[model samples]
Each structure stands twice: as C-alpha cells, then as structure tokens.
Target: MEDNIRNSDRAPLPVGLYPHARKVGGLLFLSGVGPRKKDSKNIPGVELNDKGEIVSYDIETQCKSVFENVRMILEDCGSSWDKLVDVQVFLTNMKDDFSTFNKVYADYFKDIQPCRTTVEINALPTPIAIELKCVAEVSS
Candidate 1:
C-alpha cells in the first residue's frame, strides 16, 4: 500500500511567489529575503547618510534590518532562526563593513551556527547595505 499524506493547511505568503511551503521529504527550501514590507517599494528603516554637502552611507543599520528581514521570512515558512542551515550574505562594501556586519550577525545567530558565506558586490538597489539569503529545516 502506498502512503498518503496531505498538507493543505499551511498559510500562503502574499508575494507573487510560491505559496504553502514546499517540502521535499523532510527538507524545506525558502527564497531570498530583503527588507521590503508587504506594500512598500523601498525598504523601511534605510536612511541615506548625508555629509556636510553630500550624502554618504550607513552600513550598521542596514545590516541589522537585513537580519530582521531574514528572521521574518523564516517565521513565515514555519521555521525559526535556530533551524537555519545555511546563509548567504551580499554586500556592496565588504572590506569596509565586514567587521561591523559580523558584529550584528553574532547577535542573531549566537547559539545556532549555520554555514554562511559573504560576498562583495558593486551595488544594491538603492543604498541598501546588505541582502541575505538563507536555507532552513523544519522539524518533522
């Protein structure tokens, strides 16, 4: 006899993406997440740095928000930060802000140490400091 299982009770995400977390066996894969809200075009809590007569940048605040966004996505998928298995972080300025980024990151994944990679890029949409992608597991 073939085993039958049904999972139609999961809540759907509002984004035009996959709804009802897809599960292959015991693993769950989630998509990349940013700091944008449900209806906002630009991410919240991201402020551009303005110098005497020029606008510079702020990396610490942006990095913190990025982590918060990651946490929210994980929660939506029925997973939590402790369940994360892998994480990929993208940054526009890795050299100048890597230390600060790590400082903020430690506060989130203090106990659960997931595999992580950080990459430096040319730029991101607007002045957003960091973007993170993660993979997690849900207990069966």
Candidate 2:
C-alpha cells in the first residue's frame, strides 16, 4: 500500500504552489524559506547596505531569521530541523560574510550536520543577504 502525508494546517500559499508539506516514501522535500516576518511582505527581499547597494549585510540577524522561517515551515508540516537531510544556502557576498554567516548558521544547525552548499549570487529581490533551502526526512 502507498501512503501520502500532506499538511493542511498551514494556509495555502498560492494556487500553483506546493502545500507546506508533502511526504513521498519516507522523505519530505521542503521548499525554500526566507526571513520575512509573518505579517511582512510575502517576498522578503534582500538586505542592502547603507549606500543602497547589495553588499556585505547583516549575517547574524538574517541567518537567524532564515532558520526561524525554516522552523515555522517545518512545524507547519509536522516536522523539525532534526529531520533535515540536506540544506542549500545562497549568499549575495559569500567571500565577505562567510565567517559571520557560518557563526550564526552553526549555532542553529549545530546538532544536525546535514549536507550543505553555499553559493554566491549576483543579487536577489530587495536586499536579502541570504536564502536557505532544505530537504528533510519524515518518520513514518
């Protein structure tokens, strides 16, 4: 027999978007999560420097917020970070902010050393300093 797990507790994001949670086999593929607050704009843009240019941004705050957002998504899907199998982090300035970003990121993911990849990008909406995407395993 085949079983599917879907989370209907969380509000629908959009018509075409996937729901907060979906289970296939024993793995759960979570979508990308951002640092935007619940009431903040749907798309929380990047964080910009004082000069209005995308530069080395707030590593601690942005990283923590990103994790919080991920946690929210996981909770909505009836899971947690402990089940994460991999994580992908996108940065606008990896060379400049890698240290600070690592410091904050390590704190949250200290226990789970899920596979991770960091990539430097040209730009993102708003002044977002960082973006994180993850994959998690759901218990049957």
Best by TM-score: 2
Where does model 2 exceed 4 Å of error?
A: 1-21, 42-56
Q: Model 2: how far is 94 from its true place, Å?
A: 0.6
Candidate 2 local lDDT, 1-140, one digit each (tens): 22354543433242235555567777776655556565454334345456766544466777877787777777666677798888999887888889999988788888998999999988665557777777888676
- lDDT digits (tens) for residues 1-140 of candidate 1: 01212122222233453432344455555554555555454455454445322144566776766677667656655677788888888887788989988988898788999999999988664456677766778655
Question: For every model shown, what is its TM-score relative to the native structure?
Answer: 0.71, 0.75
Best by lDDT: 2
* Per-model CA lDDT versus the true structure: 0.63, 0.69
Off by over 4 Å in 1: 1-22, 48-54
